[model samples]
Target chain A: MIRRQPPALVRRAAGPVLYRLARLAGGPPPGLRRGRDFAPADLPTVVVVVAGADEGSCAEVLDAVSRAQWASDAFTPVFVVDAPVLSPFRRAGYVVELAGPGGLGAAVAEARRSYAADLVVVAGGRGPEAADALTGLLLAQRPPIEGPVGRSRRFLRAAEARLR
Target chain B: MSGAGPEVGRGAPPADDVDVLRVLAPDEDAAVVAEELSLVAETGSRGAVLASSPGLPEEVLALVRRGVTRVLRPGEPVRAGAVVVGTPRPEHDLLAAVESPVVLGRAELPAGAAALLRALDGRLPGGRGNGPEGPDPVGPGPVAAGSSGRRRVLLVSSNGSGLGHLTRLVAMGRRASAGTDVHVLSMSSAVPLAAEGLLPYEYVPSAGDLGISARRWNVLLHRRLGEAVRRFRPDVLVFDGTYPYRAVAELGDRFPGVRLVWSRRPMWKPRMGAVQLGLVPRFDLVLEPGELAADLDRGLTVGRGDALPVRPITLLDQHELVGAAQARTALGLEQDVPTALVTLGAGAWHDVDSQLGAVVAGLRRVTPDAQICLVRPSIARSGADPGHGVRTVSAYPLSRYLRAFDVVVTAAGYNTFHEAVAFGRASGFVGVTAQLDDQPQRARWAQREGVGVDLDPLDPSSVARVAELLVDERARERCTARCAQVWPGNGAAEAMAAVEAVADGASGRELLGRAGASEGRGGREREASR
Candidate 1:
């Protein structure tokens, strides 16, 4: 999907204010532990949203998160999913929170409120394809893959490349 | 040694309670004491020698050579806050003369002197009770000796044109004593610190990188640095950059306990960087990495006594580099073929494509089969193709593989300039225009010293001339021979000693201030004698 970014002036003025406001709005979930003492505090937090109790999607997203390289134990990860799928992620030593009754939007909001992640990767499918897409989103957290393709096409190309 | 009774010396007590130590050594161990005193003076502390004879002791003269000029009359009353080191004598009791903070016997010679040195280094906590006959107060003072005594140091590097600032800080961080814990917070993207196991490294984006205004970026810097200061609780904070950010200067007032040292490299563009020099006094120490072209230095910091001078700091020592064949294999260049490495810095600050093209054309024209390797700086925004036969190799501290190339063509930045000469590689220097660095002067120094030829990128003839020298065997020998004659030993270890001293308690401001005052007094005394 192609999206237009806000003007540079607006971003320059509002970025820090919004960051501070978001930081103040929510914090890590009640029992969610802080990262290790030496871990950089500015690492982009990650929120993985998995719909329903689809075990395949949960497993795929979990696998992608485990393999990503943002430094060993550097970023904070919060998985928002159906209550039934929470055990696997929890057993994997990740912070797992059950999605509220209000569905996807509410689940994302609650996760954001709990972890304040900078990037969100949604997992809604049930195969290796979904995991590949999740991996592309994770890679997009960097300055977006540099190449000859259009901005929208770059992400899609990244996803396609990962699939192959 | 005027036989008069003890009288106090000029100057008030240091507010931080660090005493200007007076060592009264007996005749036998003077040489050993002199060696230790030179190390102490190197850390930015003045050593006072109490002598009664007309001729000074070897230790006292050694201290003078290290820029300490304070001499005390034998019977001068020891001032308050001055620690006394002397032998217990029958007629004269040095301890009983005045209320000394701490007195040491000669039996505890070097070890006792070392403890006092550590105390002066600011490694010890302030306001510990040390009476006239105190139990060795220097024993495990503030920063102790064992594993528990490891000093936490926070090194901050700014995003300069290239990795000059970050490289210098890394040199110090890697060479720091095992008892020091180092954390780096850099604005440069290519920190490479975590790879070295210098953990807890953080990257803060530069204002240009963030597309933000300098004002707002400074605000962000203040918050980020303040947060790091609180979390790291560093005993010493070292910043290496031309401009000491207002946020960094403010750190002193905010965290009084954290000793701040500014690792400032000199050879600034003449009359440039004066505004930045105003912040030098704000720091506890201004560590000036000595420039090879010191005589040619026309910059603002040229005559400044405030900064403690150390040898030119290079990340890799000469011994650390591999042999030519080994380096060639590592870089994948074939043996017996001429190769030249062109690293003109990151190309982010200034575009070097036209210059790079000229060099390639020149090299190909002179030596067709010569492998031309360009260093793809880690911080460069994007890599451009350098035509055919030229490959890009990335390496941290490229000095490690410097031997692989017969000739190195580079801009005269602090790190690359020193590394090329110190490693004794034949080189051509292109003086790139920089914000504050005096690159042209460095290139001129190289030419004058006969170590390298200065080339102009825009001038095709000059590029062709240097390109010929690159493949010429005899020219290469002349350059390397001159390099051997001119290269000063690596100052990384000495620079680390200064940092450790400042981390312990030696204040650059106090030491330099006293140095200036003492020089002033000596000037007046010489005039009176004349």
Candidate 2:
């Protein structure tokens, strides 16, 4: 990626001093690294359909997961996003992969097959739209197996059955 | 992205347009489309035209008929603009050809607008494609500065037991909306503040009041939140509560355009576990508005990791403050009178009668002619009629009528404690025993820092301290001096800047720029207290 334009930092006294101070405080978080360097070994692909609009939301979720010990060992955050969202996530220190033109469903299947994963937890932008996206992914028959979504009791039972 | 308002001058970024590329899944709701159009009109953004879906629902067509800028038929000469949300109107194959930002905030009107308006956010005026405005700015602060449209902020207040959440939000809203359009969707009784013209507000019933299950509350909250977002179309959605409602967090995906900033003030008693941190990731920024007594803070989230700490965000901002003389005049009080303001917050004080009597006694002892003003919830609620000896002041935000008092005696609650000190009044913080509050800690901090007197009404020495603070000019001056030594009263400015940064999609602590002086003040205060 291109070395992006400098960010805008507003201080009462505009100078390099405040900028260096802000820099000294810290970078993103402990777990965040600046690269696409996650191993293929992190299994059970977690499909994050990050919206270009509020790209920060997905980044925040990933940042949280990064803070959690050993969470990166179990889940791989796969991104189904437009161009604007990719750089921020990458810069924040997570290995990122982009979704092709076939849309999210095809992308989920491809990630799962490539990684040989047991489950694919899918989430989309909120409200009924999220439920709709999950339904689309789970109900697709080409995969021959319907996976579970979320931690609801019903989904848990389905996930248990799938695992069994 | 806020620069989308029509007020933006010519050659400014083209943010004033409804640019959602709605891909109708053949069987889409026309009402939703019409709602979107209405929302577009509401924000003064040029409404969108659906490209592919023909045979419009009559309601959607009516929007066009009613001068909605109508849906442009496919292959028609369409006004080209940035697409805000959803896939291209075409099927899978055509999606590759459509080089437009996808529909991220499908349910959220404001979030959708965030994504769409952002197309114009960093770009220079008169062009759409990415130009050399330097490297494309990322994170939340960039767009906060020079922008085209009015930066719309929807401040959501959690309906907690205390008014701390709502009051803090009001302080922030008043300051943030100075150059932005701010609306409050309060889950508490603070809807009345809207009537007073503090800011445009709508009341949504709290989950506790509604008596719904947590899951059900999330559903209702998201529904209400989505509706509010539709109406407000905020670039930034601020959740001012201890914890964000799950539904509100879930809306992140549906309305990816709107950046969610969590303004959580930590003073949690009972030593909360890490359960609440689960939601931390959902926010674009978890802004911890610094507490004046933050050193004494023992709240679980008070100094927990991952949050950007700002200055003490108090309700009594400098710009909106009332001077001592003006406040006395407004309340029809004698300017030279040694008036003691006993502001026992709206919390139910079991010994309220005795509390008021003691406060009055302290004032009388301080000076025989000293006036007594007890600022409580309301005259009806408190039923505090002490004849003419005590005046009942029921300012919605007592901060406005604060200068009416020479000394302020109040509960050590977050808002009142901060307000008294921020207004530069010699204050007495009476520690009220309350669940889930850090009043005791606040009271101790006040006493330690010499910013105010910590009064435990029942304690003789505490009452004596109050009396001394009221009458002793040196004591009052010392307290005022200590307060002046503390952080600058620009918490609202810092908070608004943070919100602006988040809305702008610039990451990192650009808003933390001016915090140098604040940190220095804090360091000195800590050293002085030690």
For the predicted complex of model 2, DockQ is: 0.02
Per-candidate Cα RMSD to the true structure, in Å, reads: 26.7, 19.3
* Docking class of predicted structure 2: incorrect
The DockQ values of the predictions, listed in order, are 0.01, 0.02
TM-score of each: 0.56, 0.51
- Which candidate wins on lDDT? 1
Model 2 clashing-pair count: 33
Poorly placed runs, candidate 1 (over 4 Å): A1-128, A131-164, B1-147, B193-195, B198-200, B345-353, B378-387, B509-530
Query: Cα lDDT of all candidates, in order?
Result: 0.62, 0.55
User: Largest DockQ belongs to which candidate?
Assistant: 2
